[model samples]
Target: MDPLQAAVLQQFFEYPFEIDQTYQQGLAGILANNPSNTVLLNTRVFYFNRLTGSSITVADVLAYKEQSASASESVPPSNSAANDSKEQPNVLTFAQLQELIESGRLDEIPNNKTISGELNSAPPSQSAVSVRRKPWETSNDSSNIMES
Candidate 1:
């Protein structure tokens, strides 16, 4: 199973009987109308069947959590190194810098002097495009297109 599923199952296994009952009831209520192929439904069904005061083995849960934690810890160092190499100082794109200059809003660009130098050195193809407005600006229109 995936780490997230394992984590959730681990949590469910560790919960007190009363808390588990409450959680099961809440899950049942949520899935009362539609009960098909859901994780919550599946978990509820499993725990319900095994609720006859039987002790469950949590070795798998503990081992899975430890393995996942170790794997995650090992992975971040390499990812952080790659991210450090890729990191660059924040700078406005050529188009935005130009727009700010034309609209007399140059002050809006943070570290403008540094950004301007970088933008001037970069090719025209690297410029950022302005955002376009959506066709439907407001949701108050009462007319239905299906009526006509």
Candidate 2:
């Protein structure tokens, strides 16, 4: 399977897509230097029951198929596409991925906003981010600090 360029990888991260049968499916390999253990399926992870490790290969995929088939006794072959989207980790070599991926996926990681997050309270530490006053505090020190 030919690897998708970084541009395509960025697009893939933004949206759920199907790999053209004529081409290949390797969303993970393109982004990360190697395939991570987790393959995100619509913002969730799909763990291969039989194959658990840092990377997945063609052989492992085949084994996964076999396992799924065997699990259901007396069931006929699946004729329809799976209801869930299937996005496998792209298994690119470190050099290949580094060359392709100019930027990192820090932007892609999800951030959750807590309703009642902790406020900045001063404790003794190497403090660069010093607040002269709490939000509710009347300004004396803050005025002086900001004036300086």
Candidate 3:
């Protein structure tokens, strides 16, 4: 077989070349001259840089993503029993609204009209107030005097 293939098989299967042995220890010492975090490790120049400590491989990213997906999948919100009782109202009758407050289901808005005006919308007191804006200027007005 090829020499590189033989070397890889021997190293992996038999754990040969003494990961902590003399000949390999010298080689390992030569390999571990630095413990710096280098962005250039993304390139071939990294191997030449000779990292002293352990380095993270790309498999860590894939494993992290898979673990996150599994975690979120295990706790789906729709599976909760409390979800059945959390019915949202699209419409509320006057008596039902009053009962809702008494049953502690609905909280009343302060000074909101139940005694006089509409219940579904904001109070009539709002519409009664005349909101005035700036004076309307005619399109045929005179030229604006520019001051420097």
Candidate 4:
């Protein structure tokens, strides 16, 4: 597909594109060498799911955005701050980390040295469950299985 068509279709669909490190590095090098040229790269594209197969208008999207903004605003500031502090660690691949950095969400990058380590650090430990139970198998004592 032509770049123009891809640009147009980006508004409605999340199409696959070259996001590999080598391609990005090459693009960056080209841009660095030619500062006069304007490069428009779409790193992320969001498309709403059509569960009901219903047509969606721009107004619908706008209304949904407005509603979400208002809802977030209704959340208490203290609660928001708490949420930020207690944010769960995100396990991300190198490519994903690069994408986050490029998208300007550096804070989302996990800094938990205990969970993950630097490139030179040892590999992450494997997680093993203390108890392994089959889905079809049940405990002999069924008293606590159904509680009021």
* Top candidate by TM-score: 2
Clashing pairs in 3: 34-52
- Of candidates 2 and 1, the better by TM-score: 2
Query: Per-residue alpha-carbon lDDT of model 1 for 25-117, expressed as tens digits?
Result: 555455445543344435544564376343333444446646666877865556744643343223455687789889999779754463444
lDDT for predicted candidate 1 compared with the true structure: 0.53
> What is each predicted model's overall lDDT from 0 to 1?
0.53, 0.41, 0.38, 0.45
Between 2 and 4, whose lDDT is larger? 4
lDDT for each residue of candidate 3 in 1-148, tens digit (9 for 90 to 100): 3455334333332323323334333433343443222321222122322332223333433344355457678755454324322321123445755887788754452223546665668655547776664455423333243222
Scored by Cα lDDT, where does model 3 land?
0.38
Model 4 TM-score is 0.18
lDDT score of residue 105 within candidate 4: 85
Model 3, poorest ten-residue lDDT window? 35-44
lDDT of 4 by residue, 63-100 (tens): 54355457678766577456533422234666887898
**Candidate 1 local lDDT, residue 130:** 78
Better of 2 and 3 by lDDT: 2
Error of 3 at 49 (Å): 22
Please tell me which predicted candidate would have the highest lDDT against the true structure. 1
lDDT rank, highest first?
Answer: 1, 4, 2, 3
